[model samples]
Target: MSQTKIGALQIGSALSSSKVTIQKVLDYESQIKDEACELIVLPEALIGGYPKGWDFGTRIGYRKEVGREQFLHYWNQTVNLQTDDLKDIRQMAKRTQTNLIIGVIEKVRSSLYCTTAFISNQGELNGVHRKLMPTASERLIWAQGDGSTMPLIKTENLKAGSVICWENYMPLLRSHMYSKDLNLWCASTVDDREIWQASMRHIAYEGRMFLISACQYLGSPSSLGFDTEWPDDKELIRGGSVIVSPMGEVLAGPIYGEEKLLSAEINLDDVIKARYDFDASGHYSRPDIFKLNVDQEERIKN
Candidate 1:
């Protein structure tokens, strides 16, 4: 593994529009075709719209009919794991000659999992990483992921692994990937705050791996066709997508308030050099003092 170019996609929210969002993704990919980004990452739930303000009417401690209806609509808007929609995405990655890590709301019967699909350069779906835990109100809409799908996927030159949104804060999950000797760490998130950005830097510094934190730069609700309570002055999600080096240096950007393509050149040797003294999962481990047990079996869907 030598030097590689990685880029993060910081785009606006598409609401419930998967087709349009995917088209925009392809368009952006085309725009950066010349940049030759070996690894391209998109924000969390890019295909299946990230609902920013739906409470699902659980405030009364009961599921309301209106909330059920909203759930139905959100469910209808999502793409199934086994479908032509995903097939098309794989084809696009193959055509662009680049590996992709895209966040999407994956449909499994009546449940939706916040997931990121890993597509290799050969245009094949490598695997998917579902969010292990949905934060706060997200629990109302998304389901918890099982451990079976949390393995590191090896690409041509990069050992890739992903953790959606707040799960990046999970020390055990980070250790799991670190144990695998990950070269590329993808944090597909909806968080746009400075705290999230800080986590990216810390993860890069801790793991000694290239980190790509992809976050959305969404605008007002009127444009994306969502019902909201916040004023126009407030942003739904200000993009802060960034690419950090193994030494935790900001190599690309922490772009915000706008849509942009953030790119950076990464040297695999740097990862090696950075790990010479501190390898979180390597010689730095204390297996006798700490143990992490994981379940890598895919959860059986009923």
Candidate 2:
């Protein structure tokens, strides 16, 4: 590919009901498609909302029985692989010929996973990567993902890879993607402005890959269950979605306190230029001294 124009849905957290949130995603999809974006990425847990922790209990007045019931209802309502909402997204992708990477709460049997689905331009579901490890309060709601589903998805323009939230902190995980010769790294996170932007920069520089780091800002008190009496000094997630080039340059907005669709025209040739200097998994590395074994066979086995 010559140049790829990518878009990111920097959406605000929605109410736990599908009827309430799915329309917002559709609206965002329409807006991004109109911009002639080739790839569109949504934030982590965009379908079921984020930080579904004890705060959810607090939002519903902290009644254990009622909280459990609400949790069950939310889980039941949102746990889906092929819902009408996704059908609309598929149609949009088909019409626009844009690939989609959307984050959703995936229900597998009795477990719920923090998942991101990759949909091709032809509206085919390529694959899904569940968050390897849930962070802090999130562990209460989501189960950890196994190594089975963590393959770097091959697209026409790039070998793309993803890791949700705190998984970005895992050096081994980063190395795993690097070992696969990933050209594009999708870091779907739920962090604030400074940290989010910093992490994107760090990952871009470290992995020598184009980084599409998307984040969501939790502004509404009702959405995250923070009382109005809570400190105004603290911002939940100030959506700092950014597109970092292989040279660690910010191509899009590190936006704060608003919902946005950030886009960037990425040249695939940049990957070639960067690798000419130092390909971490290739020529520049000293694998003769220390070797890291990444078993690609296990991915195909599953």
Candidate 3:
């Protein structure tokens, strides 16, 4: 039974500056070096920074010019794929000897998407999974992702996949990942509630896989080094990062109200043990009774 240490970085904030945020991420990784973590999951929008409590001057489909202005500001902050931003992360992953699942706002020319980049330990920018659907106000800033990036990474030890934020609630998507037999599922979210905790454990039990979720520990809008309508006593996002075993047990944390770098040891053998009776993609599945076809055709256009 091989054990892998998984690190969940829950100390992200609204820096908006990729250079600063990337430095902060490197600092956190340095602090976790003693843990010898093989895999690290960062919070969603860690680079672009989660947009909390802003209306963009929109009302009932009426968008003002200021909304356009705000979007341009966001666009400027987004990291371009063919640039130094991702290149630096890839190098960082290689140096640390750790696989990284980093969430960022990806810019491809005039468009932007909420994306998660999977960097291999060898410094390869393996793949990027953009959010399939933007939730609520997020649609204002991010474009929809296609099925092209909906696949898992087969690493040396465990197969990895990701579901960003509310997208975890999608049943068909879950079946898709389950079909791939992913053992290490990375969930990067901004959800700061108890219900999401249950969702993580439930997904782990359902898929018979080890799950790790990383959430941002963002202070109130003002404290986040930005201006917002939130009160002085408010903590915008209170960090509910956690890790779950294949048998639906909590291994690490639901750390709150503070910045934290949390880690937990996971035995890949537990996944096999838990799935002895139910392998969602194999003996436990009624493939003849039900079938799901995924189209991974590239849809990006100039």
- Backbone clash count, each prediction separately: 2, 0, 0
Q: For candidate 3, what is the lDDT?
A: 0.85
TM-score (C-alpha) between model 1 and the true structure: 0.96
- Tens digits of per-residue lDDT, candidate 2, 186-251, equal 988787647667778888877788889788867755456655554445566677888998888998
> How does residue 300 of candidate 3 score in lDDT?
78
Ranking by lDDT: 1, 3, 2
- My TM-score estimates for the predictions, one after another, are 0.96, 0.88, 0.95
**What TM-score number comes out for model 3?**
0.95
Lowest lDDT 10-residue stretch of candidate 1: 224-233
Which stretches of candidate 1 lie above 4 Å from their native place? none
lDDT by residue (1-302, candidate 3, tens digit) is: 37778878896745567777777877765675666788888889889777787667778858899888877777777888777777777887888888889899899878888888888889888888989999987887788999999778877787899899999999999999899889988999999999999999999999999999999888876666666677866988899999999999999998998878888988899999999998989998899999999888889753
Candidate scoring better on TM-score of 2 and 3: 3
What's the lDDT for all of these models?
A: 0.86, 0.76, 0.85
Candidate 2 clashing pairs, residues 3+ apart or interchain: none
User: Could you tell which candidate, 1 or 3, scores higher by TM-score?
Assistant: 1
* Residue 252 error, candidate 3, Å: 0.2
Per-residue accuracy of model 1 over 1-302 as CA lDDT, tens digit each: 69778988898657657888887777775766777888889899888878888887668557888988888888887888776777776887887788889899999888899999988888888888889999999999999999877868877688889989999988888888899899899998889888888889999999999999999888876766567786655788988999999999999899988989889887899999999999999888988898988877777474
